[model samples]
Target: MIRIMERIALDDDELHEDFMRSSGAGGQNVNKVETAVQLRFDVRGSPNLPEGVRGRLERLAGRRLTKDGVLVLTAQRFRTQERNRADALERLVEMVREAAVPPPPPRRPTRPTLGSKKRRLEGKRIRGDVKAMRGRVEGD
Candidate 1:
């Protein structure tokens, strides 16, 4: 099970992982063993994610999500296949959790209070006076 958040958990079946060659630095063992993991998740068909969250994840994934609606991630940083697999799953879960939380609604616009407006005008006036003082005291 992939636990995303307190309430969100994805079943192992929902995740697809395949072993492949890693491009990163490694010895001959790297060439022989498929240590890289490619993980794909179908956000559009997942029963685990909420409708809104799935939509958001699809959008957040951008190019990662294919036209068929699969979020694809390649994990080749780790040396071992298991490690690479775990890394991919961890990253996917984290991203899902992040996308699960919706942004807070925007606050309504407000006009500056009368006092604040007055204070701002006064500050502008003071600045203008200070700048005016910088002018040359030429004409007698």
Candidate 2:
């Protein structure tokens, strides 16, 4: 099981990994070896995640989240399959850990202070005056 937080733990079966040939650098090894790791996690169907965390994970996944609600992460930075696999898993854990945190409270709407509003208007007027002075002098 992978521990995301004190309350959240994911089973190993929750994660699915696939190996494919990695692109770039390695030359002959790149052509012959399947080093890239693709990690897929079912955010919607997972029994391990809380409903709120699941929703946040889905949002955080963004384009990585598929239409079927699977979060797909590909790791190809490393040359070895083991490193790439570990990288993918580590990324998944980080993502889940992020989702575990509660969102901040919604901000309350606030009106501009009278002093600030006056200052803003004053600044605008000053800017207009400066721009007006830049125009060609009518009597020059």
Candidate 3:
């Protein structure tokens, strides 16, 4: 099981991995060896995810998510297959971990305090005075 948080954990069977040729920096190995890892997770079908978390995960997945609700993550930063695979898995875990957290409560609308309103008006008055002084001098 892949633990996202204390309560949220995903079974290993939920994840599907595919190996493909990696682009850049591997010389001939890049063409021959399938070092890149593609990790896919079914967000919509998973029983492990809560409804809130599922929705959040789908949003977080963005373009990586397919119409079928599978999240695809590609990892080719590392040259070795093992590192790339681990990287893909780590990315998935991080994404799910982020989704597991609850969103903050909506901010309540607040009116300016009387003291702040007075201060703002005072500053505006002072600015107007400064601007008035800059007008054409009568003695000039």
5-99, model 1: which lDDT tens digit per residue? 88889999988888888886898977798899999998998998998899888888989989999999999987889888889988898889889
TM-score of 2: 0.77
- What lDDT tens digits, residue by residue, belong to model 2 across residues 17-136? 999999989989999999999999999999998999999999999999999999999999999999999999999999999988998999999999999999999999999999989977
Give the top-scoring candidate (TM-score): 1
> In model 1, where is the ten-residue run with the lowest total lDDT?
22-31
- Misplaced by over 4 Å in model 1 are 135-140
Model 2 Cα shift for residue 9 (angstroms) = 0.8
Cα TM-score of candidate 3: 0.87
Task: Name the weakest run of 10 consecutive residues (lDDT summed) in model 3.
Answer: 131-140
lDDT of 3 by residue, 1-140 (tens): 98888889999999999999999998999999999999989999999999999999999999999999999999999999999999999889899899888899999999999999999999999999999899776783
Better of 1 and 2 by TM-score: 1
How displaced is residue 119 in candidate 3, in Å?
2.2
Clashes counted in candidate 3 amount to 0
Candidates by lDDT, descending order: 2, 3, 1
Residue 122, candidate 2: how far off, in angstroms? 14
